[model samples]
Target: MSVTAITASTNSSSVRGSANATTNCLRLRRSHILFGTEKRYLSNQCVQNFRFTKPSNECGQRCIRVEAGWLFKGGGEQGSDARLERSESANEDILIFFYQLDLATRVQYALNLEEYDIAKQLRNKLNEVEAEVIKQREMKRGSSSKSEAQDKGISLLRLRADLQNAIENENYSLAAGIRDQISKLEADSLAATIKAQAFEKAEFEFRLGQKVRHKKFGYRAVVCGMDPVCCETSSWMENAHVDQLTRGADQPYYQVLVDVHEDPNLLVAYVPEENLLAPEEPDKAKFDHPYASFLFYGMDSAGDFIPVKQLREKYNRPRHEVPYDPQQDQTGDDNA
Candidate 1:
């Protein structure tokens, strides 16, 4: 009987403990349901507020919360989904700024290039101006040199004219002095020319028995027995015989001969070597006959042979009685 009573007591206590556990579980379930509903309402309000606010107004708040959540996730906070979105936007803004800055730099560079081109063109123009200035300077130098040469020529011409006037007026002393000056100038100027030509002035001294040609006379013997007083010295002169008929009574019959070629018979006056020149050859057709030769031959009053053209002229007169026929005796003498 004692064991049965103890068992009954244990059963009752177990039932009471089970009933209290069931009540406590039901209350806990209700409290959890109420808490879940409150959480859902808070989530909906947060979504609404995020959607209604302007991007400029909500960006800061949204970024803060999103960033906090991303950090809590701990998958490299900067590279997380929400953080990546913000970084992309920032990158776009940076790209736009760089593009604008690049465009502005390009425009400035183009303007600088244009200025450089203009400067190059100006440099070319300056070079042309410098070349023109050099050309003008050279031309001026040439003109000045020409002017100086012309002035010198004019002075020389005036001096020559003055000397000529003095000579014409027979101012012997003045003319001589001026001539000397002119000669000196001419010698200075012609020094190189004279050296090149190897020319010499005429000397008064001459050799005896030397064969010389003259202007009027053809050829003759040089007789050196006679004496004549000349400008420089006494010269052994050339003498030639002339018929008395050919000479005038007042004329000096024994004329001194200088150049034999001027007149073979020494009929003409003696001329200095400075003034002497060769005579021109006669035309062959004009005097080709024996009569022409005879006309030049010498003869005396009594028909004697004399070494003179005057004697030939006095005796051998032109035969007017005869016709000028090639077959006729042109001298009108039929003695042959």
Candidate 2:
């Protein structure tokens, strides 16, 4: 069982009627099973009950139970290891992202200071990070590169033809191998087709470069990319308590660039659709993520980030026009 230690103090009066009476102080430490992230804290009233009138040293340390019901709550006693492993994995992803952000920031600083040598080295590292991000995305989808529909169809047909020839030649072993390959190719093709349909239907709730806030964590972010459903590994899903979400892992997930001003530790977050909300008003303030300049052109009048051509192309997204605002135009004129 998951546990958290809490200490409470109890007071005792010895031989109350005697002149030489002395009071004894006893400290009690209790362990409670911490279930979910949302409600981990024990209340003051719960702590106060630990103060016993007849305090005993033997009872100083005891184990208690708490009914934890929140998002990502494990199923039972066996879930502890899964939860722990998941947490460690998340930490690794965050650390890697942090390193990339640091590199990008250093590259920008070097350029500003006219340190060409340092900037070149940092920029190279930043490029590595960019490539890694793309590779990781493809890995999640079980593909090395995005292939066109015609290419996939043609490949499948060629494999099937090879399988047929092998079978006709009485090459049983070769035919079996070809048959397995054909099955795998068909499965991949089907998955790709479904994903394409999802995109074509516009199933995503948020658009690329749109500003949003996390409903639970309340951090401001901009949508960078999205999946029809969570594409993270099983271990990552367990650690993130993705199963605990209202819509579960079957719902859309977004790749968001978090506002560094709000949370420097969290520069990027893969969040669920239900957890994101659009801002009621346009926020024209500067966003401080390192990837902001790399992935986007600039903020528009509506306070939304304008995605760069490359970023839009990567996600097959169309160009977005900045909403016209007379007040913004007037402000620009006044500044001029």
Candidate 3:
């Protein structure tokens, strides 16, 4: 049947697997949301919209969704109109994340096979990826913050002008309303600046792209994003049992990509920092996730996924380099 829109909701099931690797099977409830007559389905990945010409098994599969000419959005009138319905940031981040993951995976595979030369080349490439991630992050921060501030300044100027016009016209009521709006806008701008500063000062125990395990649930996950403090609503915080934690919901929270092999339905998870810990040893095993292909460049010697440049920039995270271990190559060679 032709579909216009679809919504998914997740429900938890009995945990499965080893005690240290338990996972909840999440079931999605489908519902319809009507947009234009164009058929669309909710995507499991960054691709938010889809059009299907035929009934296919791939309907519910995870993928990075990109519309035709997505890059051209906001380039012209048609582009400007389409911008209202699409966000390019998530799709771009997924593409970059996949690249990093692929590179890291190849590096790990080469090392596992005792191909030191190939691993060396991949390692060099990993360094290059890290540099690019740092560059992109700096550029995003420089440009985004500047643009946001400029936009806010321009808006304030226009509102002030309107307030002046209202007063000149002896429209006291209109002037009062405009003055209130201006005050609120200025207050919001100040709050934004404060928030940005807080983010810069925020510290966390975990870094982006680190591999971690759930202390309570025993699920393996990789860090993709983080907040200085828990940012969920009160209701969500209660449901998540955040109140019971010794650190409470004031601690850092992370956006993690769950291993699909463990729980295919639990794609992206927002977890508290207190609930996560770095693995005791490097996990050499493959980490299976639908978004892994696009969200990470490669696995490091430490078994952590290298997040793509865009992904790093999205969270304002710095690039991380795996420490060099000369003995690692010798060990691989001995194994070979």
Candidate 4:
């Protein structure tokens, strides 16, 4: 079973007062069977009110630690070692289930289960992942020169990390072994953020961009962005431009963004491109539109602005299946 499935099965309890003992025993056996292990010594009294998570531990130390190849070691026996070695094969399944959890979620799960030691281990794992991410960023930027590479270990940029090195140092053989370790770290997590999010579908000739100016707003003013009108467009525009700019209406219009010289407040006017013109005094125009960073990735060396990543990561994040989590832990899990 998956970790989530295991957690759910372990956490669930529904039995009559008379049958509680029988239910607990049966369930415990089932769990042991599922884990491919014989039952460990657990008291009947403890089984009566059993919970997968720790109920009371003032110091909040984890009672159990799940490791990849740990064989329940302590007493030396080759037979036990053989059994443990066999357990490792079974435990590989458990490790894969654990990793399916989001990094933050795994930490929260440990903390909520009162597994502080496990949480600490996960925190350490987080640091390693973050270090790998920073290293990848540096490697992509070619920051690992000879001296710098010696100072920081061989940085892996992933996907084409080896390719970049091979091309740089001209070693094609090792480059062929490149595997994309980056797929795990590239947490776009911005699936909700729409790309090049143009607000209106009104057929217009000029592609909406900054550096455009409002005739009445004067020289310093620039078109920062366009948005959809909630109600009809504001009636402030001189009757020359249609007032309404809501989406999906006849002659749908855009709420053009423009800065006012006198008032520092953001000014959005519902109008067509005809209502605005290119900045007459190009020298005075400001291309540093405030919304550009959120909308566009930084400009390339060629002076051309690049759009942000259009493709997004999956949005279906795992939900908390276990109950009885503390409020603070629950809040952190919500963020995860």
- TM-score per model over all chains: 0.15, 0.47, 0.47, 0.24
lDDT of 3 by residue, 1-336 (tens): 222121111111211112221112122221011111121222311112212122222433333222221111112353232122121232233434554555566567667767666566657755665566556554433333444556777899999999999999999999999999989888877755654554567788998789998775666888877766665556666666677888886667777876655544345667777879998889878887656766688898888999878677767678988888899989999999
Residue 317 of model 1: what lDDT?
A: 24
Q: Give a tens-digit lDDT track for model 1, residues 208-258.
A: 221223323332222111112121111212222211223211121111222
Full-model lDDT for every candidate: 0.28, 0.58, 0.57, 0.33
Q: Which ten residues in a row have the lowest lDDT in candidate 3?
A: 30-39
For each candidate in turn, give its C-alpha RMSD to the true structure in angstroms.
65.1, 17.8, 16.5, 26.8
Error of 2 at 24 (Å): 61
By TM-score rank, best first, the candidates go 3, 2, 4, 1
Error of 3 at 24 (Å): 28
Best by lDDT: 2
What's the residue-level lDDT of 157 in candidate 4? 45
lDDT of each residue in 1-336, candidate 2, tens digit only: 111111221221110122321233323111122211111112321111111122233332233333332222222343332222222222233334444554555566667767676567547646755676667656454353235444677999999899889989999999999889888888877777665555445477888899998776666889887777677778778778887889997778888877766655454577889989998888777777766776778887788999877667666778988767798789999999
RMSD of 4: 26.8
Off by over 4 Å in 1: 1-142, 183-336
Candidate 4 per-residue lDDT, tens place, 163-258, comes to: 687768967565555433333222221211111122222244323333454444342333222222222323333233333323222332333333
**In candidate 1, which residue pairs clash?**
215-279, 217-262
